[model samples]
Target: MTVALAISGLQKTYANGFRALKGIDLEVRQGDFFALLGPNGAGKSTVIRILCSLTAKTAGSVRIFGADIDRNFPLAKSFIGVAPQEFNASLFETPMQVVLNQAGYYGIRRPVAAARAEEDFARLGLWDKRNEQCRTLSGGMKRRLMIARALVHRPRILILDEPTAGLDVELRRLMWRFMTDINRRGTTLILTTHYLEEAESLCRSIAIIHRGELVVNTATRELLGRVDLETLVLELAAPLDQLPPSRFRLRRVDATTLEVDVRRETLLNAVFAELEQSAIRVIGMRNKTSRLESLFMGLVQGNEDSTRAAAAALSAAAGD
Candidate 1:
């Protein structure tokens, strides 16, 4: 597969001397659904900004489909489309105008831009609202409008930053379907979201950034396999006086709930059998957290711990 996007030794520092990205390297294959995730203040946004040519990198190289951003930014940008985290369309402009103007930025002619705008509006379920002012649309509609605007020029690679934020469940799923369809049609997608389930379910590969560094990059399933233990929340049919002994670690949540830690090697049937032997009836059960979420937290926390330890050692050395 062709590499759609590439970054090597990427570094970014702000005017205030804040190092937002610390020499990170990453790649996404053409037509692949990729997830770039990090907590607030991490370098995910910096990377996105650099790729979109919205911000200059302090050092390092970036290429979009083999076109270098520094040497051939217009060519590189021609292949990219970005739907940013915040709403950016003119409040007074109609959705159609907002999308058409975005197309115009890429030098798309008015007739062609209008046709593409109409197609995107219908695809995003905004056909009827296309003539209305952007400020009048609901939050979810505004999000969809931004996505439609990004697609107006028909860029091959789409970078979505928190695309589903502030959306209802139904609308979020609808957006997911639209994104999946585009990816399936050979458009590469890059997504950043705090929704672990969305990343785990939609992205083929994942990269996590922590404290301005690339922490991990691998297949979603491979990252998820790192989780050795899964917690299950069980709703009991009856209140318990005390907890029953079992091979799996179990903790009481309330009079009628139990939290059980089941290792990957243990079968869920074993848990049910143990509970049955103790006459504990589970009326309902679900995972305490998504497996990917558990692994992500562990990686981020471990990175933080290492950073703190290294800083402490440096401080002690200075004192010595």
Candidate 2:
């Protein structure tokens, strides 16, 4: 498979001596919808900025579709488009002017740039507001404007950092649909967002960063499968005075509900059979944590100690 992006031993340190990334090794294959996940200060933005040439990396190697970023900065940058987390557009410029000017920076002639800008604006639902100043648009519209600006270049790989941060549910879903379409058409996507649920739904593969260190990298399905125990809440038809003392561990969540931790190997039928014996009629059941959220928390929280301990090593190797 052709690799869309690759990073090896990536790291970043601020002037105040904060290590923002620690030897992060990651790859996103061509035509892949990938997610780069992390909490605040986890270096997700730093990584994106480095790739876009906005921020300098302290140490590491980065390649965009086989072009080394350092040796072939121009060509490598040409193949990438980035929509950063923060808005950086001019308030006085209209949507059309913002997009057209962005296209001009890449040296596209006026006619071609205008056509591409129109296509992007129309697709992103900004055709009507094309003449309105960016400052006049709503928060959601401005977010879409950033996306349009990024796509105007038609780069092979698109990196979006928290693209839907302040968008409402309906607008977020709209953007998801648009992104999914482009990804299907072979535009490799790297997404960083606080919306874990969105990541769970769109990304086929994921890599999670914690405290400047890479914690989890795997297929989305495999990540969810990391946790063997699933806490399920079962609604009982009848209220029980107390849980029947038995081998099956059950917690009385409420008058009509009970909670149980079910191992992956254990069948739901087995739990049903145990409840049947106790005369506890089961009406409904649901998992306490969605599969991805369970795995994310476990992986990040599980690495808490190791992440902190790596600091000494990071400092020792800084001069390299």
Q: Each candidate: how many clashes?
A: 0, 0
Which lDDT tens digits does candidate 2 get at residues 164-230? Answer: 7778888888889989998998899989975677777899988877778876677777655654556
Instruction: Score every model by TM-score.
Output: 0.85, 0.89
Cα lDDT over the full model 1: 0.84
Please give the distance, in angstroms, between residue 256's alpha carbon in candidate 1 and its true position after superposition: 3.7
User: Which residue pairs clash within candidate 2?
Assistant: none
Global lDDT scores for all candidate models: 0.84, 0.82
TM-score of 1: 0.85
Q: Give the 10-residue window scoring lowest on summed lDDT in candidate 2.
A: 311-320
| Regions of candidate 2 where Cα sits further than 4 Å from its true position | 245-247, 290-320
lDDT for position 199 in model 2: 76
